[model samples]
Target: MSVPAADRGATTVAERAVRRIAERAATEALPPGEVLAARGAAAVRGRRARVSVAVTLPYPTVLDDAGERVRSHVADRTAGLTGLVVPSARVRVRALRVREPKQGAEAAAPVARAGRGRSGAGRPWSQRRVPAAVSAFGCAAVCGAFLYDVVRVHAVGRPPARWRARLMEWLVTHGPDSGVWPGLVSAGAVFLLGVWLLVLALTPGRRRLLPMAAPAEGVRAVLDRRAVSALLRDAVAEVPGITRVRVRVGRRGARVRARLGFGGLESARRAVTEACEEALGACGLARPSRLRARVRTDPLWRAPTPPGANTGSGPAGSPASPSPTPDATTATTATTATTATTATTQGSSRA
Candidate 1:
């Protein structure tokens, strides 16, 4: 096998890096000294990138103008930092605020931005944010404690806090083997935590949303896996023979299963594949998903006939035409079968 020239010198940018760059760019794009907060998410393929940014704006700012600046700046900064061709950035105005208002105190109402993180693809840090935020909070708490103690001792000449005194006393009295079982348990916990963090760092996060190419200028978006599945099913339903469809979308591709109601099995299978592929293309994913469609004819289900189709007795003495099958759309509404036969009749025929 030979590697392509582009693959030979590939430079892969991390999703986390792109997110930070976008967040910084959004903040910088806003008015000087007016930034509240900005968070971003990104999906990058080769040298092309798609990004989503969510930000808080100060009260009484023109939303359209702020969004425009953010979109342009993020696109520019990401391109500059990672050398990626960013077609567009999806900027979401998450809120309007200089500071969060207290309960019962009226402030400028926060703006609503449609959420995109349900599938975790549009989250600022994917799955890493929670762990990273927790670690940062722990460190900040320690720093805050020291800062408070320093300020108190220097400015007011107060004695050390009782909490700190108790902690020191405990450390002095507690030896490594003081609580044998507890010490071993704590050691094991710390080791497990270290290993988990290491694994998280080495592995890529899973995303349940597909990145979409921008349909319009300066506007990229992502579609959730559920939405993709629903779209594929709807598309398959429109096919001539498809009675039911189940679509599963994963990181690698999409798997589709279709039930053919009444048609040549092979032809229906081909139709299903074509329908799914066409609908997927319309989905606008940055990397079009690999598609696999499986089709089977179902004996229990039937496709509905056209509204004007004739159902009549055969010409002359020919057998009467069978009644047309019930409409699929109306079948579910049926409460029970209408036919019932109970009689003492008995017939024996020899052929």
Candidate 2:
């Protein structure tokens, strides 16, 4: 026997409703693979319907609460879209995804531009100034000491100490006989030191800031290297199986170091590399940079605890307890007062 056209249409509607519900459930805050493993079905009897869904989360999720949220959202969306009244939804977490290291690179040129304000161009003054001042002071002190020794010799008209006379006589005899190698090496060392000091004094002591594409015609955008590094670190850390992330943002390239917790190292490397690349693209740097990702497996790895999550006693996935509710009598009294005030204001406005 052939099915009625009305019955066939109803079946098609139910199937679409199930698919839409499953799609919505998988997309919220969860990664791509987690949702792809999800399956959902809907059955309609008269105007009422039931939704059944199963999903596999990549990480440990509070099974009870997460399931409840997904079930509720699915039912609501299905009911609204289809004209069916969804009474209940059944949701189950089939499996937890294995944490594997993922690595990828983003292609973006980092902005390389001069920084404004106090520290600009080169190394900071705090690092270079102290060393330069100390060198200058030491050179002046040595020169002063040598001048005093010469003046003392002229005034005394004879050697102040016999050792000084011996040293001078030794220098006078051996200095000519000594090879030029010793003198050349000493002179070269001194010249290099002087050049270093000069460079330190002249160069700016600031980190290079990465440039970004200008937002407007007359405006310029720049991001600090430290900020870029922090952004990449956080992005890489979000990938599944990654325990720790370290990022170094330079003018020409970015280096990402990721530590894995479990699963295949190759998968983890690919995931992490892709994540880093996405983050770099989002950063919107003007100059494209090479991305170098290194993934290392850490057998003893432990994921960092999120802030505000209790480690001591509460059930997994349960949020902290809310504050106590206000007294019913107080709430009623406040509502009454507000209503009366609004009534009086309306009466006065009419007058």
lDDT of 1: 0.75
What Cα-based lDDT does every candidate model obtain? 0.75, 0.70
What stretches of model 1 exceed 4 Å from their correct place? 1-129, 136-188, 198-206, 214-220, 299-351
Best by lDDT: 1
**Tens digit of per-residue lDDT, candidate 1, span 1-351:** 998897787678998999888888888987665664466789988879899888888766788887798789889988899999999999888888854445543321111111232232231235688888897899899999988987998899999888878877765555356766655676678789889888877765546766665433344477788998999999889988777888898976999988888866777888888888888988867665899999987877565666865557578656666765678535644523322111222222221
Question: How does model 2 fare in lDDT?
Answer: 0.70
Clash number for model 1? Answer: 0
